[model samples]
Target: MSRPRKAEDPIRLPVPCNRCGQHHQTVARWPDGGVCGYCYQQAKRTRGICAFGHEGVLPGIIDEQPTCRRCSGIRLNVDCVSCGAEDELDSGGRCWTCALGNVVDDLLTDPATGAIAKDLIPLGATLKSMKRANSGMTWIRQKHVTAFLRNLAVAPKITHEIFDQLPDSRTREYVRGLLTEHGVLPQRDELRMRYNNWAA
Candidate 1:
C-alpha cells in the first residue's frame, strides 16, 4: 500500500484550481473541484451575498456560484508544508512567514557558494525572524534592495570599510543599520569611537 499522505502535504498533482483557474498545486479538493493556496485564502476573506441568500464571508463554490460556509460545508484548512502553519499559503505551499524567511535566505546566500556568507548569518537569521511578515515581504521586493543584497552576496568580505566605500544613500544606510544591529558588521560610531580612543 502507498504510504498514508499527511494532511499538511499539498496535493501538487498540477490540477486546475477551481477558484483561481490556475493549473498549479491545489491544496483543497472537493467533488470535481480543487482550490489553490492563494485562492483558498482569498475565498476565506471574501464577503458577499452567497447563493443561499446569506451575507457574510462567502468561502464556498457550489454549482459555479459562491456559497456560504454553512451551506457548502467546505473544509479550507491546509497546513503549510514548509512550516506547518495553518494560515493561508502561497502557490508554493508555504505560509507568509515561511515565504519571507525563504526570500531572506535566498537574498543572503552567496552566489558562488550557494550559502549565506559566514559573517552575514546573524543578519539572515534576524531578518528571517522578523515579526511583521507583511512588512518584511514587501521590503525585500524593492529593486534597490535586491540589487544591494546581490552585490553584498558576491563580495569577498563584509565589513564597515566595505560598506563605507559604497555609494551613500538612505537605502544603503538602512541596510547598514540592520547589519550593525544584528552584529554582522561591528557596531561602531566611527567618529565617536575615534574620539573615545584618542582620549584614552
Candidate 2:
C-alpha cells in the first residue's frame, strides 16, 4: 500500500486569487504588468477616453502612454531665453511668458543721448526679430559701440560690470529699466547691479 497520505503537505502552486487579489484567477503574469483576459475586455469597452481628460486614446491601455494635446498642457519647467531664469510657465514647448508679449519694448529715446541711441537702432531691430528660443547673439550684437562709444557702457553679455558704468547722467537708466520691464532682461535689480558694478 502507498504511504499514508500527508494532510499537511505544502501546495506547489500559489493560490490563484492571491495572485491578482480581485481577479487573480483570471490574471496570468505577462512580461508587462499583468494579463487578465477579463480585464482586457473591460478596458476595450473603456477605450478612447484618455485618463488624462484629453480627447485621445487612454494612455497605457495597450501598455503605452498617449500623446498630449498641442495646446493647454504643461511641457516642463525650462529657462527663459531672454532672462536666463527657469521661472517660465510651460505651455507646450515654449513658456507662456515667452509666447506672450513679455519681451517687446518701444524704442529708447532721450534728448541727451538721442544721437547715439539712434545709432543703436540697427542692432535693436535685429534683436526685435530674433526668436526667443534661438541663440542670444542677436541680443549680444547690440553692445558694440562702433558709431559712438560715449553712449554705451554695457558689454555683449550685459554683465553687471558693464551696466553699472552706464553714465547715470544719460538715459541709460531709463532705457535699461524699459528693457527690464519688457522682459528683455531678467529684472531691474539685475540690470541695476550691472550698472552699479560698472559705475564702481
Candidate 3:
C-alpha cells in the first residue's frame, strides 16, 4: 500500500541533450538542460585566441580579439627621473648619472683655497651645477645665500656664549670635542680631559 505523491515534488528523469545527444538527469523540462557541460565549454573556447597565441581563459574581448591580462599592458612601467632612459628607476627616482651628480666631490673645490668652495657649503649649489657655466644650481638661490651668510656670521658667538653658561668643565670639554670633530674648532688637547689611564 503506497501513499500518493505530491504535485510539487520534483521529477527527475534521464533527458537526452538536443545538441550532443548525451543523456543527463534534470528536474526541469521547459528550459531543458539540452546542452551538455562539455559541449558548452567547447563552444565557448571556439571564440578566439589572444594576440600572443595563448589558448586559455581570457579577461576581455577587445576589437573582436580575445586578450589575457599580460598582453593588455596592465603592468606598470616606471621611468628614470633624469634621462627618462631606463625602465627601472632607482630609489631616488633617478638613473645612475643623475643620482651621482648630486654627490659632494672635489669637483666643487676652489682653485685658490684648495678646499671645497665656501659658496657651496650649507645648502649651496650641488656638484651638478659646476658642470654647467650658464645654468645655476637648482637647490639654492641668491636670497638663500644671503640669509645663510648672515646666520653663519652669528653662529660662533652664540655657541661660545652657550658654552660659557655650562656649569661644569667636563660637559664643556665634551661639547668642544664634538665641535672640533665637525671642523667648527681647531683640534687641541686643551679642549679634552687631561688625565689618561696610564698616567702615574
Candidate 4:
C-alpha cells in the first residue's frame, strides 16, 4: 500500500521597502528602523549635522546631540603620569599634588648629598667635603649622613663596629643619638636580660 504524502510548508513572501516603497526579495527590518539597501549606503557616505551645525562624521554623542571630532576633543580626560589620577594635565603631565609630593620625596632621597648636606648638619661644623666620608675625618654632606643612618638601620652589620667606623666624631655622636632614640640599638639592661634568659 502507498503511504500518505506530508503537507509542504508555505513559501515566505517578500516585504515592501519602507523608504523606497518597492518590494525587495531580501529586505530585512532593523532594530532602529527599516531602510532599503540603496538608502542605507547613501546614508553611510553622507556626513551627519552636529548640534553646532557643523557637517562632519560624528565621533561622539552628548546630550542627544551628535558631535564632530573637533568638538569632542574638549571632553578628553588626561591622567597624571606618576599616580594615574585623572585630571587636566599640567605642563609636567602630573597633577598638582603628585608633582609637589614627588619633588619633596626626590629632595629627601637624592643620592648626591652635597647640595642638601648643610641643612642636615649643625651650622659652621667643619668636615672635609667628600662624596662619602670614611676614616681620617673627611667632610661629608647631609646626603652621606642620611645614607649612613639608613644603611645602619637596615644592614646586618654590628652596630658598635659600624658606629666606630664613622669619619667624624660629631656625626658619629649624632647617628648614635638617633639610633638610640629609635631603639635600633638594644639597651644594656635589655641585652643583659636576654643573656640571662639564654643561660637559664
Candidate 5:
C-alpha cells in the first residue's frame, strides 16, 4: 500500500539534471531521470561507434550498450535552423540560447541611436556569456523587465543618483549592481570614501 500523491503539488524547477548534473529546468525524463536542455543536446549529439556497426549520433542505450536511435527505436530530433546546431529549439526553429542572445540584443539596443549605449556594451556581453542563460532569460521575459531594459537603453544619464531616483525593486537593484561592476556607475565603497574624507 502507498499514499496517493497530491494532484496540485507545486513543481519546483532548476533541480539537478540527471545527465549534466547542472541546475536547470527538466526538459525530458528518460529511464535514468530528468534531463536539462544542454544535457539533452549533448545526449542527442553523442557520437561514436555503437555496439552495432552503426556510427554517428549514438543516442540509444540498451543493455549497457550505446546504439543508434533507429536501432533502439528512439525517435527524437531537435535541430536549430539558424545555426544548424542540434539543440533544443525554442522559437523560430532557433535554440533557446540563441533566442536568449537575440532578446538581450533587442532589449539593450537603443531605439534613438539604433545601437547599444556605449556604456552598456559590457552588460550585454555579460548577459550573453552567462553559462546557464535561463536566469537572465527568465528575468527579461517579464513585461516590466523588458520595459525597464528598453528604457535604460535610451537614458541619457547613467549615474548613481539617477538610478536612485527610480522606483526601487530587486530588478532595478540587480541592473544597478551590474552597471557598477562594469564601471558604468560609480562604486559605492563606504570605507574608501571614509578614507578620502579623513585625508581631505
Candidate 6:
C-alpha cells in the first residue's frame, strides 16, 4: 500500500549520536543532534564572549598609560603654568596660558644694554686711540662715549667690548663673567690677561 522509496530521496549516512549508542541515518550531518548541538552552541557562545564576559570580541591591546585627551595628565605630573600648580595640561605638555612666560621674562630682563657694551668697546677703542693721537684728549672722550652709547642702543647687541687704549683686563674679565654664566670657564683666576700698557 506504500510507494517504493527512491535511492537518493534522502541519502542516508550513519553517524554516531552522543545521546545514544546506536548510529542513526539522516539527511543532514547532524540530523539527530542532541548533546552535540548543545556542545556546539556552548562553544559558539564562549567564542563570542570576551574574557570580561561582554557580548563581543575582546580588544587586542589595552592602553596602560592613557592621559586625559584634553590635558594629557591623567596622573597629573605636569605643572600648570597658569596657577603655578601641579595639574594636567589643557592640551598636554605645556598649557596655553603658561606658554608665553618665556616671552614675558625676555621683555623684562632683556640684555640689550649688555649686548651694546660688548660690541662698542672693541671698535670704539680704535676711535678712542685716533682721537687721543690727534687731540691729546685722553680717557674715554665725552663725544665718543655718547656716540658709543647711542650706537649700542640700536643693533648688534654684544656683552662686552674692549677699547684699544685701555688695558684689556676689563674686557677679558667681562668675557670671563659671561662664560662663567654658561658654566664654560672653569677657573677665572687662571685665565691669562692681554693688555696694551700705555707705558710699554
Using TM-score as the measure, the top candidate is 5
TM-score of each: 0.57, 0.21, 0.19, 0.23, 0.62, 0.17
After superposition, the stretches of candidate 6 with alpha carbons farther than 4 Å from their true spots are: 1-157, 161-190, 193-200
TM-score, ranked from best to worst: 5, 1, 4, 2, 3, 6
* lDDT tens per residue, model 4, 4-57: 323322244255445444544333344323545554333323347888886645
How do the residues 1-200 of candidate 2 rate in per-residue lDDT, one tens digit apiece?
A: 12332232124423332213333333433323453444433332232445456553221332254322222232323445654534323344444335332322222233354332433444454444556423332233244321123334223444334656655533355556545655555564555655776899
**Model 5 misplaced stretches (Cα beyond 4 Å):** 1-59, 64-75, 189-200
The digit string of per-residue lDDT tens for model 6 on 15-116 reads 543333334433223222422333322222221333343332221112422122122211223455565543223444543234333222322232654333
Q: Give the clashing pairs for model 2.
A: 160-194, 163-194, 163-195, 164-194, 164-195, 164-196, 164-199, 165-198, 165-199
Runs of candidate 3 exceeding 4 Å displacement:
1-74, 104-200
lDDT (C-alpha) at residue 184 in model 1: 77
Task: State residue 54's C-alpha deviation in candidate 5, in Å.
Answer: 12
Answer with 4 or 5, whichever has the higher lDDT.
Answer: 5
The residue ranges of model 4 lying beyond 4 angstroms of the native Cα positions read 1-147, 150-155, 187-200
Q: What is candidate 5's lDDT per residue for 30-61, written digit by digit as tens?
A: 76577666666666657688888876666667
- Candidate 3 TM-score over all chains jointly: 0.19
lDDT of 6: 0.33
- Clashes (backbone N, CA, C under 3 Å), per candidate, total 0, 9, 0, 3, 0, 5
Backbone clashes in model 1, listed as residue pairs: none
- How would you encode candidate 1's per-residue C-alpha lDDT over 1-81 as one tens digit per residue? 123333333345545677656665677775537876666667765667886788766677788788776788876654589
- The lDDT per prediction is 0.73, 0.39, 0.41, 0.44, 0.73, 0.33
Task: Give me candidate 5's TM-score against the actual structure.
Answer: 0.62
